[model samples]
Target: MGEIKNRLRKDLTAAMKQRDDFAKSTIRMALAAIQYAEVAGDQARNLSEAEEIAIITKEQRSRTESAQTYADAGRPELAEKEAAEADFLTRYLPQPLSQDELVAIVDAQMAATEAELGAKPTMRQMGAVVKAVNEKVAGRADGKTVAGLVKARINS
Candidate 1:
């Protein structure tokens, strides 16, 4: 049902009715981003749930970065606005995996790979291992963080 996308649409309607300018604008931007991704390349197809989440996550990151830039440039007001938008996007994302949870996942994947290969997997196999771990992670953790953990687990 593309729950996130649908929810955003419904929320947009509610925001408009309530005259909530901030929410209305933010949700509109999010839905536009999602719609843009849906038609990004050849065919203009629908985005899966994961792809939709990824798109929104990327938007949230941009907002967060913009907030930092504004703060660094001595613009607290703009920074706060961007930060608020980023925080709003968080409502649609999966609850982030804690460090302990992520570490456990990395450890489990490495152990399973070792058992399958009849020896410990090396840094060379990190790609496959990371891919597997990312599938398990869904959209809960950042990819770079997952890769770093997998790298450390495989190395030591």
Candidate 2:
């Protein structure tokens, strides 16, 4: 019942009314995934906004990976379908950080870590830097990308 969840429901209804089969199906799948996440564990609970965003992010990632697998298997049609679904779900997530923004964040975190250590942070401290960067990035950038940047910055 969060904003994005409500938006997805409204969009699903709109898609159905417009006779847009693919959008309707994709949105339905997203909703089903969110609902499943809600009931996934010991007790039923409403998802906080962050939790809802995480579920949507997970669903989007699943579709993107599925699309890649289908493409690798040479199924262009199926790949396109999954890719479209992933793109649609992106609306519910925050915009990804641009590369320059990402670099600035990593650099800032590296500096902070360096200050804390009273010396330039070495690769050994990459984990701390990455953790700090991730906290600032707040899911906007992929973890691997952040780690790679942090490693490169440490090396340089």
What lDDT does the true structure give each of the candidates? 0.94, 0.88
Candidate whose lDDT is highest? 1
Residues 1-156, model 1: lDDT tens digits: 477999999999999999999999999999999998888888788789999889889999999999999999999999999999999999999999999999999999999999999999998899999999999999899999999998888878
Off by over 4 Å in 1: none
Question: What are the RMSD figures for all models against the true structure?
Answer: 1.2, 1.7
User: How much lDDT does candidate 1 score?
Assistant: 0.94
TM-score of each: 0.94, 0.89
CA lDDT, candidate 2, residue 65 = 99
- Superposed by TM-score, candidate 1 places the C-alpha of residue 119 at a distance from the truth, in angstroms, of 1.6
Output candidate 2 Cα RMSD: 1.7
Give the residue spans of candidate 2 off by over 4 A. Answer: none
